[model samples]
Target: MSERKKSLITTINNQRKYSQVAKAAVLSSAMLARKNSSSRGAPGSAAPFGARESIAAISDMLSTQHKKPVRSSYVESDRVEWALKIACTISMITVCLHTPRTIELFPPLTYIILAADFISVSVFMLDSVLRIHYEGIFRCDSSYLSNRWSQFSVFISIIHLLSFLLHCYQLIGKLHFSEISLILLFSDKFFPFLHLNYRVWYGVIRSIRPFIIIRLIPLIVKFKLPKNRIEQLLKRSSQQVKNVTLFFVFFMTLYAIFGIQLFGRMDYHCVQPKTDPNNVTIMDLAIPDTMCAPEGIGGYECPNPMVCMQLNLNAKGEGFYGMFNDFGASVFTVYLAASEEGWVYVLYDCMDSLPSYLAFLYFCTLIFFLAWLVKNVFIAVITETFAEIRVQFSEMWQKKEVTLDEGFRKKLEKTDDGWRLIRLDGEVEAEGPKQKLQWVSSL
Candidate 1:
């Protein structure tokens, strides 16, 4: 062959070798990445495949070898599982609908509710057991028992067991069993003086059945968009949320302390004087416009000492109901005022009781800080965090798309050898073999 032709062939051969080497390198890197990913059994590190896992693997192999393949037609379908879940949900809803009054008034409904409870509890127990067996034994997950779902399952089982016993007690009560026999069977007749009313205990257990609705959380979390967004929001904004909460609590406590100091002992209320025809004075006839403190305090005396009764300042005149009875009560009252719900009444009471009108300033300042400023700040923080998270997700998605596009372009470039060959033919036609030969020789 001519020197020019040989030089051209050598140049093409060199290019082909370079392409093969680059492809090999890429393949090798990909394989290495896959190996590394597969080797990593846990976060941040590789886990050793232990002897127990080896034994379990061997047992699984032996079991599968002996096990007969089941027909797909006979297999339990997802629809069946979902049906059971729906039924369980309905049963739980029925249980929630049953109140003590309903059970008492409608005697026959009690048995129906009991039956529903039994079905729901049984389904939950079965599901929990299957989950535990699958996660702990079949999957051989050591941390399965420590999982929140597993813990919740265990809790549900315990409560259901107690509820089942209560059901039995309730049934026995319906059977008209003697109280003495019941006390002996349950309490071992230890406290004969203590009244053992199984009915009341049964009612308490029934009340707790409403909490079974929490089981639906797993189903609710199946909604990917909302659930994932909520999870991301919480995870990314946890520190910000904590900071806001701390600030809110600190300010609330400060306002509550101020409230306690200002209105702690201000229990004065307007009381109407007695109007008797026989011994009626002008003061007695006058409307009770003056405020009087609770009895035993040396405060303003009313016109009718015999008949002036202390009026109830607020509904439910207990410590908790009082606006500023104690530190805890003051805190709750401050929360109410900050929420701006029925706080005008409290403000009026405070204004009426206190001699000065500075109470308005205190409340206005509290409302401005907590209700207006702090509330808006909290909303803005959450909104900003959500926006940031959304932007980050969008950027990641764009990067992924760009990477995919680059990979696709590289694939097209690799596959279009015919086009390259055609271009090379054109180049040979445009510049004769002698010129190509000289170029190759120079290279």
Candidate 2:
């Protein structure tokens, strides 16, 4: 080619590249202007502290960091993003299987499980960092952290990360690295106070994995169902279910406190060696030593001891768990009694030597308060919330009228009254139906 032709071709290529870049810049600016104009009248639109400002700040930070636009979408259309989600899911499952309980179930695979867990955790950490960077971690009210479910998911991941660090610390201690570090540092002790069971922490971390499913709402929402039928179905009961759950938790806590004060401190020991004089009662009346001995009539097995020790023997009587022998058992027992699910048996178990009337009255009062009163209150709250939500859903469904364009092949127009379905011959369906009725009447 001639030198003039080569120069012309280069100019054309340069012009095309510049044109593309110009188009991108124009498109971005137009989108920003459109968004700003649309949001002008909205709440906090004029305020610099609004969501748009925060979003712009985040976007600027991300662009500064990567020199590129960050991709974000409510739908899972991107293959790379979908692949990452799947990888995270698989990694979470792998870590869950390697929990302490599951590890104990399969002892021989301990090392293999631990190795998989570590690899999965590393992947999770990388995934989290990527997500934070993409979501603009510099902004306090960024979309990622502003969302409740996102916050929950990130919090759990952070806890799991800490648990992983604890695992590493445990490994270091097991390998006597702590001792060597002490010698190297020329100190008497290296992290002497850093003592914790990493296995238990890992188990706790694994238990929190189930909550990650809440953050998978976008995936479920993205499903191509007919008219968002799945979302409608979920909406029907979601609010009521949430209300019931909160009420149940509140009542359970109240009942747990009641049970702890009432029956939790009772110690059932057949042989009462000593007793507090001021605290002496008829329940403290101990059976003869012969009766409690191995060769005795009861054979040292008293299902319901008549004598009660002043000191609690329930799991060393230390923390709440120790004091009750089981943290949730007291609440559960009260619940079972309130529900009338074998309340007689529970009361019988506690009423061997104590006054039967007092115990019966105490239980009957609890049944009245929890079963009759609280249950009705819970029902009323749920019913009211459901009714309100039903009204809102009806209003929303009715208001959700949509118009569709079926291409230029089908002519369409709107009238002052409502939409007028137009045909090629300038006929309207509403007029056609009326004209047909008039013709029939004339005949």
Candidate 3:
């Protein structure tokens, strides 16, 4: 009887254990079902289990992820950023030295420049490829090529790449990459013409390369110089610079039109060849045969001091008005004149037939109004903006301090209303009473 009672107790214990396991399984299954239902309703949980991405998606991923492989580890690093800046500095210097004028001055410098260019181009090309990968090739709305600045950078990089290749071509001569004997033999004949074309392209590219200085300017401005006073000044005066630039454009356009009217129909002439025995060879004269006076004694020769003549009122070719037909040329010429660079030559060329007083008036107007008055205006505006910016920065710093004290974190958020600064705390609602209050008080 004692053994049978002990066995019954063991069986009861076993049954209780089994009941507990069954309860656990039921509870777990119920919980899983609830989780699955919730997940199905949740946003961004619609993807089917183990579904493969489409070929287009995979292609895009491959294209966009080329840089992603190293981006986090290298690209955003401060060390890399500084390295890039150094590379840009190198590039800028290389570009300056490689200019046709500079190269002409120092021909042997091309080899050194070519070496430097290789370094610069390699850096820029790698960077450009990575940037394009990051921005995505086919993203029309937000692609690498979409932003004007990005486009400028990529374009500059490509042109520089071509320039580098051209340099390599010149250095390598008729050396063939492939083992085709026909190409190798005939390359001697074909390469010179090809190189000549390349030189023309190289010149054009080099001329445009200076515009890369625009890209370099911003980088230079942002550089952390020892004093940082210049940076502070530039940051403070940014708004003023923008405003003044706009006004200057408008002013320049107006003056350019005025300049076109004054010097539109104009030309320069040479001594009447037939009349002057010193010029026995009529063919030798630069002036057209029609422009020279007859061989008679009383023939009207060009003026002694100057040989320039006024073109017919409706005349074209090389005159200010003829050039003005293109808007870009007109603006460039006017601004070029304003810079006083070949302004004297242009002044002499334009004013040969016009009154001397007109020259005085034109120079005075440009020097006094554009140079002095306009310059002072910009200076004043920049000074005002600088003061305002200083105050603005001070206020911003104070606000940041206050937020830190209040245990609040501010973040930039892009909403329907556009980018907005908002506190992370529950105290500030996204676009409700708290935001409205903050905006009103800040104003």
Residue pairs in candidate 3 whose N, alpha carbon or C atoms collide under 3 angstroms:
none
Query: Compared with the true structure, what per-residue lDDT tens digits does model 2 show for residues 414-443?
Result: 679764334445543555887889989999
Whole-model lDDT values for every prediction: 0.60, 0.53, 0.58
The collision pairs in model 1 are: none
C-alpha lDDT of candidate 1 relative to the true structure:
0.60
Total clashes for model 3: 0
Quote the RMSD, in angstroms, for model 3. Answer: 19.3
Best by TM-score: 1
> What is the C-alpha lDDT profile of model 1 across 1-443, one tens digit per residue?
69999999999989967765554443333334334655775665652423222222233223334344643531145764674467458657776666668877887887786777677667667766665655563354444466666687567666866776677666775554787456545663566455554546545655655565576666545532323344656777888888898889989999999998887845454443445433334354326344444445444444554343444343344335536867878988889988889888777667656643557888999999999988998998889897977654553444334432322232212344431111213333547798889889999
lDDT of 3 by residue, 342-439 (tens): 66655654444355566567666876666677778888997787676564454334433442232224444578987554555847457889878999
Give the clash total for candidate 2.
0
Candidate 1 ranges with C-alpha deviation above 4 Å = 1-80, 137-143, 178-196, 199-211, 220-235, 272-319, 384-443
Q: In terms of TM-score, how similar is model 1 to the real structure?
A: 0.60
Highest lDDT, which number?
A: 1
Q: What are the clashing pairs of model 2?
A: none
**Ranking of candidates on TM-score, top first:** 1, 2, 3
